[model samples]
Target: MSTSIKQTASSTTNPTTTPAAMPVKTVVITGASSGFGRLACKAFQKAGWNVAATMRSPERENELNTLRNVQLFPLDVCDRQSIESTITSVMETFGRIDCLINNAGYGAFGFLEEASEEEIMQQMNTNFLGVINTTQAVLPYMRKQKEGSIINVTSLAGLMGMPMLSLYSASKFAVEGLTESLSHELAEFGIRVHLIEPGAFKTGFSSAYSFNEGQATPELNRERGVYKKFLDNMLAEPPKPFGYGDPQDVASLMLKIAQTPKSPLRNVIGKDGKSLMLTQKLLGKKRLLKVIGNAAMPKLSA
Candidate 1:
């Protein structure tokens, strides 16, 4: 993909330049094409912050132009050269970026045994490596200014285990660990970072996930397919906790964290996610293991 940085100077003044010393809080977001990324870009733009919404394909970007304060930058996080160049262009146009949201990622779903090596790497490279590259690119500016925020988007799978989602879980688990460690290390430099762990919201992520091999593993597929009836019956009790979370609900929470004076190191995004975490905390090792084990797939009888 060809990358282009269309830079336009704002008649709007930078607070950093003034004696009043208003912080020039610009943000650079990766994966601005869709999902939470798209919603976040608009939300920040509406809040009157200078936004650089970087997508893989900028030529096809007419939607972002409609927004008043967002600049569209063509950035593919997987390409190191592209990431570097995009960072340069962002620096040139905006002067300094106060926040870098590493939001570009796709889910890899289905049974692990059927997933290929290539599929796993694709998910990891984009989900985990992309965050690393973007954070490294922004570190210089944030360090020079000695203040910034890096927000990493993880998932409920990042915290808890689930059936048929091992690869996806691994990728998010990596993000959880990465952000948890970096939050402490970067605090000393006047740079603050955060992680957002969202639950299953209807961003179409589940449907969009890459299945191991859509047609492979016929037995597993058939078992799950017919057993869908069993699970549906199991769920038909007095109903569980809350239902699917709205994406805007999580997005609003993320915005609050972004705008707060000092955001927490980790912002858990859904009621269900928060509930699960509470249970894990209260239950501790033994009970949690039993709960996870019961839901896990049964071993084949040898």
Candidate 2:
């Protein structure tokens, strides 16, 4: 089941002993079926790196499968066995994993009160625990290599909470903290752990948005009515002030972070993301909250 591709040197001398035959660096990206993950697979491959694109259903994928140095593997981050097996398979195929991108997560929109127990658990497990599982599975290989990078795709929500994304924000916030702490812990091992916080983008994530459908109890229904406008606005297209970004930009940044040895621990991508983070840094929390409040719910803010 190995999909390893070895490069051959063209020199008359022995190819095995030639410098040109050095093994290509490989990156394992989860959620590579579409969005940033898919683009990253292409970016790394185009840059002459081996790519192990792992999705929940590799059988359903067609694009990356057609690429030269890219291989697809079935991976479900929520399942520990799947993560371990996928990592093992990737290691066997690529022979070396220089980078790992934990990017397989979905958004859970709606008010916190409207979120059912199952919805909450799924959000936490997929966004937070999934990162942990995948990271743990890849750490041993990266540690042995003694020089690797781990780029985690968190969101702008991780930086600041917004309306209708309470659970999603919480999950991302958890990853933000985990990544920061893990970066410090893994610094000595030569494994650089970084976080990429992207703002709204025109990606499959918008279409894959998961709106929490809690039980239709009388109280919950009434609550939904009160928050309907805010929820709708949040679900709608990004406001004029904060338009969606190009997904390729995020993918490019991922590739850069993987290649750079001293990349920052946290990278905020997209114009909107950078602006919001800048505002928070300069204007303080109170002003930042007002800006977010006005954007998310003008009527409620007024």
Candidate 3:
């Protein structure tokens, strides 16, 4: 990708000029090509905030390119240089960035044993370490401004364990911990760290979901056969407690997080996610595990 910044369409007034037309707060959203990232860009722009919609492929951008005061920047959270350059462009274009939404992670599915070493590393790098790097890159600017919000888009998997999503869960769990800790640390700098725990959303994320091909050896193939049956059985249940949701809801929640003063450190996006969390709290870990395990997975022989 080119290092040059892909800027947004001009609003009624020039976003460059200040304090004349409308006061515009700016937000930088990663993974802005599709799903929640795309929707949030539109939502924020609609709400009168200048949006820095950063994506890996700004060349392929469509709808956001038409919106006013919504600049497109090339950013790969895994690349420190890419991140730094994007922030610089954002600063140069928008004058200030009031929010950073770390939403550039893909789902890594299947058992831990099935995943390759590279897969595991990429999973953590994109989801956890990427968040760290992006946060670090943006902190100096936020500190200089004396106020900003850093929203980490996590999942229900971050809060609870699931059968096939071991590695995905682990990465999100790390993000949850990081966000919680940063909330306290950054509060002194007038910055807030928040996590948006969205449940399963029909965001085309599954298209990017990486499944470990565990068919390398005969033994592994057999293991995968059994795991497949378990996964099939689990998915057989239609209308899951946490059924798939519209990406727009998640986008709206993100806007709320960015705008709301004194928002909670962690915000679960859907009713199903909130319900699942409440169930865990009420049932306790042991009982909740047993209930979910029996309900979601096939029984394996001892």
Candidate 4:
């Protein structure tokens, strides 16, 4: 079941009143219940663009429902049916989709050997395949319009692999590769593809994180203690300095990317993200790996 609520004309100017030459733009955002997705909805709506904020459960949401020109629709990127239904509903409500933001994903943290098959599949399905599903569902509509943008919210982990977040990083890396390729493939149709790689931000992402420890086998269980300690140290003090920034900055970047035609293909946002990317570029892979190893497990490296 899907629910969409829009503010009345009293709260917002009627779209019909706008000059026919300049129609209002519309954006569809996934994972709109919290974090960057939620903020992006507000940013776009504030910019006078219609916002279709899609999430898994729209009935439970209260905040976005009151905003002008912002509607909530139930959408699960892992489920193709939900994606199709939500896109259809958004088109019905707003008439056109000028941008699509694939921000629906979660993190699964654990060593690769300890991760269960279910965990691996779930991580890949939601983080990687989910983006693919949502992007595919919207392509036809954007193609018909002959001009649109798809902005994918990936992580800095996508660029540099984090030990405990191997699966999560892999999923994001897949998105990075996919979006880079699609930029070229979709250019002819006037559709632009972009990637927003953000570092740690003050959001619910950490709270939503899933950890895998019980999935380790009896033999691997003994070794899990060592891995757990390494994970703990990494979390307490990461190798690369990352300071959490306001998630709204990421939301604003998404809006900028959507509105700017000649925007760069991949944008690395946040102070920590920029610093880490620059470090990697200067030090190269081998030196960066050694630095990460020393920082993550100083005693062991020593």
Candidate 5:
């Protein structure tokens, strides 16, 4: 089933046979190999939208390829040429990309000291630069069409500073700022920019993430004693009482954003995501830092 995401355009021009006024809106999602991107591709495909699902390796995403409405494209957003080629290919086939979803980022959790500068750059490249590259490609199409949407997937960590996820947070924070500024610039073009802030979703994002290489070793106070135990507990196995959120939940919210006449520039989804945003937004940064510091404090006495 495909979701009909339509845009009302007045006329068609040139070699580009623009889609119907109530045209089958096309969606291009990066990182569709897994997680939210996969679910979203399926959701839109089922809803009848033309979905171009992209990943670094199309062969690896055979399952996603099985979906009827989606066309898999090879994309590595970090690569300038690959990003450009992808846009050309998609436009040649799909005519226009009504929505571009930037969902291709992974967590690299570690103390800033443990993570190398290269690692930090890699995180930012995939997480933040990826969006910039894709948006650059999609802009001209939307400019001509005079309507489009750019949906960015950011994390709660982006909004509030977290301990171990420093690099990840930095990357996402860049995305938050990038999306905010770009939104204002694109609005005049009749384009909408939205950021989806999700909590810990059960999309294997945690397991897929890499920790500081040697931090897990048995040496150098790796455990850090009781404090380490607490950190481990926080990152322990799932079956979380509330169950890590569903990717479908985020996908559903994406559809809501698409359908709504005017979507909030920033949408925080899931109870946990909303809760985090509330805490960070309501409690002054200093106060929030105090709470976090208190929570991560080691029991020096013990």
Candidate 6:
């Protein structure tokens, strides 16, 4: 199921010997059913790259399937064996994976103390460990090619923690660290490690966030009540730039990062996200914490 890259007209005497154009680069994007992943598939395809738009359920994909140079594959980042299988299929189909987008992660929202052990572990496994597993599986191919890029879609939560997103933040923070360390380690192999720290995007993530349903126990329920107001207040506030953002922006940023030769290891995706990160760097830890805490939960002053 290989998707053919778009070609331009050529006027060489010997087409076989002269090479019509640069070899088509293939990108393997996890979680391509929706959000940034979906848009990135279109963006890459528009840029003349063959896109392996891998999702957990390819049957549900409608948009990317209509596009040229995009093939949908079944992939689950949390499942190591499945990841390996998907990569193998992609390699067999396309012959190379020039870019690997680790974008198959979800958010787990709620008080950390109230979340069940299962919830916590699932969040970590899907978000942090999933990236680790997928990257490990793809590194062999990327290494063999000796020229590939691994772009991780982290979040603003990875940069700064906020109320009720403890587990989500923790998982993203872990990815941020992993990307940083791997950048140093994989640099020699020409494998550029990049992390996309997206801000509040108008995606289904909020509605799709996994909640701690197991926290209904009397003791945990009472504990949840204690933190409910803070969490609620934080959740109620409208996101910067007038609520959620368009996923296309993040997709564009990802395309830009992939095209750039010396892109930064950590790339923030939105205006607000960049502002928040810049302020944190200038304000230092204590001051930044104070600012973010106050902003996240405005009722804290009361």
Q: Candidate 4, residue 136: CA error in Å?
A: 0.7
Q: For model 5, how does the per-residue alpha-carbon lDDT over 139-202 read when each residue is reduced to its tens digit?
A: 9999999999989999888887776678888889999999999988999999999999998788
Q: Write the per-residue lDDT of candidate 3 for residues 140-174, one digit (tens) a residue.
A: 99999899999999998898887678989999999
Please tell me which model should have the higher lDDT, number 2 or number 4.
2
> Across residues 149-247, which tens digit of lDDT does each residue of candidate 2 receive?
999999989988877789999999999999999999998999999999998898867668787877446755655665665566655766467688999
The residue-by-residue lDDT of candidate 4 on 1-302, one tens digit each, is 11222333335567455333478999999999999999999999999999999999999999999999999999988888988988899989989999999998999987688788888988998999999998998899999999999999899889878766789999999999999999999999999999999887878775688887547778765456676666666455433555578899999999999999999999999888787778889999778867766665435322
Q: lDDT: which candidate is best?
A: 2
* Per-residue lDDT of 155 in model 3: 91
* Candidate 1 collision pairs: none
Model 1 Cα lDDT, one tens digit per residue, 1-302: 11221121233355244334375578898988888888888888888888899999988987987888789999988888899999999999989988889989987756677677788788889999998999999999999998888889998788766666688789899999999899888888888888888876767564466666644576676655543444445334422466667877765665677778488888887777788788888998568757765654443331
Report the number of the highest-TM-score candidate: 2
The candidates, ranked best first by lDDT, are: 2, 4, 3, 6, 5, 1
Candidate 1, run of 10 with poorest lDDT: 1-10
**How many pairs of residues collide in each model?**
0, 0, 1, 0, 8, 0
Residue 232 error for model 1, in Å?
Answer: 12
Q: In candidate 1, which residue ranges exceed 4 Å CA deviation? A: 1-18, 21-23, 214-240, 285-302
Which regions of candidate 6 fall more than 4 Å away from where they truly are? 1-20, 213-237, 240-242, 298-302
Candidate 1 lDDT at 131 equals 89
State each model's CA lDDT, in order: 0.78, 0.87, 0.85, 0.86, 0.81, 0.83
**TM-score of model 3 (CA atoms):** 0.87
Angstrom error of the Cα, residue 35, model 3: value is 1.3
Per-residue lDDT for 54 in model 4?
A: 94
Off by over 4 Å in 5: 1-21, 213-232, 239-243, 280-283, 296-302
